[model samples]
Target: MTRPTHLRIHQFAGLQPGPRLLVTSAVHGNEVHGTKAMAEIARQLDAGQLTLRRGTLTFVPIVNPLAHQLDRREGDRNLNRNLRPPVIAQDFEDRIARVLCPLIAQHDGILDLHSFQSAGQAFAMIGPRNNTGELEPFAQEATESALAGRLGVSRIVEGWLSTYALGLQRRQQRQSDGSRRAQLISDPHYGVGTTEYMRSTGGWAITLECGQHLDPNGPEVARLAILRTLVFLGMLDDAAVEPHRPAQPPEVLQLYDVIDREDMGDSFEHAWASFDAIKRGQQIGTRASGEAVLAPSEGRIVFPNVKSQPGTEWFYLARPSDRVLG
Candidate 1:
């Protein structure tokens, strides 16, 4: 199959109109599982095996064409970070965002498929239950949470962009230059990504981290998630797809903080994967300045990236969330 060279959406609408749902993958070029899964879905749709029953379903299998061409994480900059139309369309990602952001706004719900850098079980990232003065003020938390629960994932995480904003604030306080702080203050939507942007546009969205990048099973997860989302949104008949249930009750985690890599020599004490448990006051890594990086509280480590650039997020800390699943 030929690859896409620009932003394109494949849309299918049912005979009777209902809610519009947008499903996207490959927002990050390196994550190919979602792309493969979406391709499979497109093939089935074209073959008349899968049909939308109520509403519209749109697919954007590859969001970042330039990065996908190179098979890298990003081109010029990370497309999933700082997702807003640039005042001047300078880089390729900026121009893509101009087209992608509006397309997201048109949908009622979104299921953004993604894969992570580390080895871990698949999990869903949800927004906060309430708009707590975050950059994105959304009232669709209940709806979003419900959508997340039905995605066939056992673990759900909240507090992504808000916690990232908090980390930038902390960095600003400690550093003399305060570049991160300035960026946040200057851009109210500093940490906004696809889901956050969707929330800001008055739509509910959930990001499903299918599994580790390159995991063969990740595509299957993505495929199931797409079908599950369609069923949950009433776009497809439930009888058309098999019901999915996790082996155990789902666990919800609230990400509280993000640890930044300070220097080139910064490294984790071990090859700590995502969801690795850590105790309060335990040394997780060391800074290039020879300072020990300790956990401020007991929680599971999220996204432990050893290859992170200096001053970028090395890892995140999250604990059990008190909010009940919708």
Candidate 2:
């Protein structure tokens, strides 16, 4: 079978049949750590230094080559969002998605690697059990959750769609009076990224944010994550791999709200970083009209992007989730 010309897929098949795993990196052009890690993994496998004991493993080092060449988040638009079957390939990402989604659907597990703009510890974004739309028949929420825990990250995030929907609802609520509230859109079930699409196909998937985009540690994290996943899936012999201890049980965080830049006005009060702690009522930013943007509640700030466009997410607020599973 021929692969898409725009991207590359490095594949390895074992003698014994087993689960099929798809690991992708550089979905965003600028996040190159995962791409580098995948390259190294490919090299090791090619040289016979690493072996797949069972099943099939496919690695797409650069999912968005044009964006990677441009050194931007996307070629034309955010490829991670609005993942659905394309009626027509109208843009660069759309064309790629059309070709990529079908391959993703064939996998039993997926790991989409990424990095953030701000400095922070690595974490895995885990989807909620209830979010599995069509893929629920193939894998259950408990199975996906177990797979996420084995990724060697210290933090796991859930409620991604709920948080995004909350942001949209808040925006609509502000636009309307209490007597005439706008009707909120129904949940699409599928998210805008590779993981969501994979889950929708009944395959377990997780998005690993391997720290800051340019951090040296990012590549290492990505490398280890891949190795850990192989070991976790029993695709590799642990005795043959280097011995390493996994991180302490991860802390589960449930994102509840997101603040968009459009609602915040012109600029932030200060340069905010991801995972910054915010006290209730603290000034987080300033509106164009000189109004202060205060923290709605005491929680940690995540995904704070100072350069985000107006009407797009500026930052997210999250609290410790009571559901902690390893």
Candidate 3:
């Protein structure tokens, strides 16, 4: 069957009225595992094998259909960035955002499924707490954090907005120092993705990174995550659907900084994989001037992009944090 040109939403309403939970996949077209998982969930729902006991479960399997059709990350722009409603739609993604932002406002919770460029264990990206700036209006800080803990992932990352802001600030500083001018700030709102946009509208959202984009296991991980989220929200009977649990305790990571590529001469010492441990003072890469870029502290690297464009984020550095949901 041929797919529609625009976004497609699949709604599974339950018998009881409760919170609305939204699940979005394929915001980045190349990350297709979530789309597969959503399709499977829809199949089970249609086949009567899966049931929603309370609340509504809505799925957007392909938010960026154009990108999916092209098998690229984006059509005209990255749909994940600057998710706020625009005064005027600028591109294909912006036009979709104009329609999507209002729909997201109606949800109480969201799970945006995605996969990263590197092969690694699944992780959940948790937005800032309720009292934190844009999230202040949403008084469900504790609830959101607790929901992330229930995701059954081995790692939970926090402080995405702050880290992103820091990266932008660093880029601006580099531009002032005679480095090649970086791309002008396109997302001044600093809203990173679907999760951030949902959170801004007083809904709790989490970005679940299933695994490497091309890995067959990615879809399975995404499927389990959706099931676990349903159980966490009490939409599915716990006895009927057992959530996936890790063999060990999950490690919490707090993002502190982002490393952006400053110049064309900047490059990595080796093909560094995501989650690779870096000891304090270890040389991670080289600058445009051939100066070794050393690790500021002991931490594991996340989202290391060896082929990242100049003046864009090459990787992120994160360390263990004591924050946990009670």
lDDT of each: 0.85, 0.78, 0.80
| RMSD (CA, Å), each prediction | 2.8, 5.0, 3.1
Candidate 1 lDDT at 144 equals 77
Question: How does model 1 score by TM-score?
Answer: 0.93
lDDT of 3 by residue, 48-79 (tens): 89888999999999898888888878767677
* Alpha carbon lDDT at 97, candidate 1: 88
Q: After superposition, how far is residue 163 of candidate 1 from its true place, in Å?
A: 0.3
Candidate closer to the true structure by TM-score (higher is better), 2 or 3 = 3
Residue pairs with backbone atoms closer than 3 Å in model 3 (clashes): none
Q: lDDT of candidate 1 vs native? A: 0.85
Residue-by-residue lDDT tens digits, candidate 1, 212-256: 998999999999999988888887789767887767668999999
The segments of candidate 2 whose C-alpha lies over 4 angstroms from its true place after superposition are 1-5, 130-139, 170-191, 240-247, 263-265
Q: Order of candidates by TM-score, top first?
A: 1, 3, 2
Clashes of 1: 0
TM-score of 2: 0.88
